[model samples]
Structure formats: C-alpha cells, structure tokens
Target: MLAKRIQPMVSQARRLYVELMFQVMGRALQAVSEVDDAVKKETQALPAGFLFEMMVMPNGPRLIVEHTGLGRLHYHGASAPRPVDLSIQFKHIAHAFLVLSFQEKTAVAFANDRMLVDGDISYAVRMTRVLNRLESFILPKLIAERAVKEYPSNLHLPHKLISAVRIYLKVATNFVETVRA
Candidate 1:
C-alpha cells in the first residue's frame, strides 16, 4: 500500500522536475545564444524565425526556442504559437527526465529509441551541437562532461569560468523578465 501511494508522488515530483529543467534549459539556451560566440554562430546557421521544440509525449513539459534574426535566440516558453522547424519528442516523461537529469546522454537516449524527432535531421544536428556547447558553458566540467558527448578540451578554465558567469547572469535577468512579463 505504501509503495502504491509513494509511486504516484514520485512520478509527480519527476514531472515537476522535468518541467523546471526545461524552463532552465530554455533560459540557458537564450543566454548562450546572446553570450557565446560559438552558439551565436550556430544560431546564425538556422534560418531567421526558426523554431525548435523539445517536449515529452502526452502533454508533458515543453521548451521552444526561436532563432531570432541577428544570430540570437529567444525562449518562447513551453508552447509554440507557430509551427516548429524541428521537434524532439520523448516517448515518455521518464525518458525526458532521464535525459534532463544527466542520467542519459542525448545520443544514448536516441539510440535507445527514447525519443522521436520531427523535421530536418540536419537542423536537429545543428541544434544538438548548440545544446552541447551551451551545456559546456552552464554545467560544471564534471557534469558537463557526462551530459555532452565530449567536454571541450580547448575550453581552458579561465574562459569557461568567465563564460559561465556571464551566461548565468543572463539567465537570471531573463528569469526576472519572464516573471515580470
């Protein structure tokens, strides 16, 4: 009986955690596009107004990022008002939680058939590269190494530290603006 009751609570908590992770990731991507040259260059490769979405199937948390002109990105919250250029949908919330929590690398999740991708494969690849770069900026080296396919060897400590600080500051400011709006 206790196991049955606890299961629901655990599932709900996982859902909430996934939702929060999506939000933070959206903000972090936005920060990365604005502050990281490599990310900006990647975004520039995407067409202006391009929208990319990542979500869990059956109405779970969603994140949408748009490639605004001028090599910038905008986080459009959990919904897409317009059709997205690329959409990555996890088969279940558990799969999404696993990937978001760094228990699974994205390629591993894809290999395990944990998610589905819609739209251009090339665009998805580009977005993955951007996400990897963004992760390197925001996550600790140890965690980032696990989250990304490979930690960038060229990113020396000083550069990583400075970029991380700037990106985090942008994320905070974006969060405040989001709360206000």
Candidate 2:
C-alpha cells in the first residue's frame, strides 16, 4: 500500500525534474551557440528552418532548438509551433537527467537503448556532434571528459576559459533581453 501511494508522487517529481532540465538546457545551448563560432559552423550544413528537440517520453518536458539560418541556432519556446524536423527522446526521466547532468555520456545512453531519435540518422549524428561541442564549452574539463567520447586535443585550458566567460555573458544578456521583451 505504501509503495503504491509513493509511486504517483515519485512520478510527478520526475516529470517536474524533466521539465526543468529542458528549460535549463535550452538556455545553455542558446548561450553556447551564440558565443562559439566553431559550434555555429557545425550547424551550417543543416537545413535552414529545421527544428530539433530533446524530450522525455509520455508528456514530460521538451526543448526545441531550431536552425534558423546557415549557421544560426535559436531556442524555440514551448508555446511555439510543433513542427519538429528531428527529435531525441529519452525513454524515461532518469535517463534524461543522467545525460543532462553529465552522469552518462549521450552516446552510451543511446547505445544502451535509453533514448529514441525521431529523424534522419545522419542529421542526428551531426546534432550529437554539436551537443558534444557545446558540452565541452560549458562543462568543466573533468566532467566534459566523462561526458564526451573523447575530449578534443586542440581544446586547451585558455580556450575553455574564454568560451566559458563568453557563454555566461551571452546567456545573461539574452536573459535580460527576454525579460525586457
């Protein structure tokens, strides 16, 4: 009886957590892409006006990132249209959080059947590479090493520091603009 009573609460908490994860990731991706030219370049080959999303299954939180131009990325809000060109969906909230928290590398999670990709495989691979690049810029070296398959040899400490600073500044500025608008 106690287990049954607790299950619903646990489910609700998990749902909330997944939603929060989407919000946080959306903002961070926006910041990183805004500040990093190389990261933007990764999206240049993608189709313009294409939308990509990362979501949790069964009505959990979802985040959408759109390729607005040749090399431009934008965070599309929940209130926006639902015309997703590609989506990566976690099978469960725990699986979603594990990757979001950098507790598990995304490729490992995907290989373990923790996620589902609802789009072209080639495009998904390109997006995965972009995510890895953003992770390198935003996460600490130690955490990023564990999160990515292999840290880039050329990403020296000074570059990481500069990128981090730029990301933070851009995020803050965007936040302020969002509030004003």
Q: Best-fitting candidate, measured by lDDT?
A: 1
Candidate 2, 1-181: lDDT as tens digits: 9999999998788677777667756776777777778878888888888888888886678889888886778887554476799989899888987887788998999899999999998889988998888888878889998889889889999998999888777766766777899
What lDDT does each candidate get?
Answer: 0.90, 0.82
Q: Which model scores highest in TM-score?
A: 1
Q: Candidate 1 — what's its lDDT?
A: 0.90
Residue range with the least summed lDDT across 10 consecutive positions in model 1 = 34-43
TM-score, prediction 1: 0.97
State residue 54's C-alpha deviation in candidate 2, in Å. Answer: 0.6
TM-score for each of the candidates: 0.97, 0.87
Query: How many residue pairs clash per model?
Result: 0, 0
Cα RMSD (angstroms) for every candidate in the order listed: 0.9, 2.3
lDDT by residue (78-143, candidate 1, tens digit) is: 989799989999999999988889989888888899999899989898999998898888889898
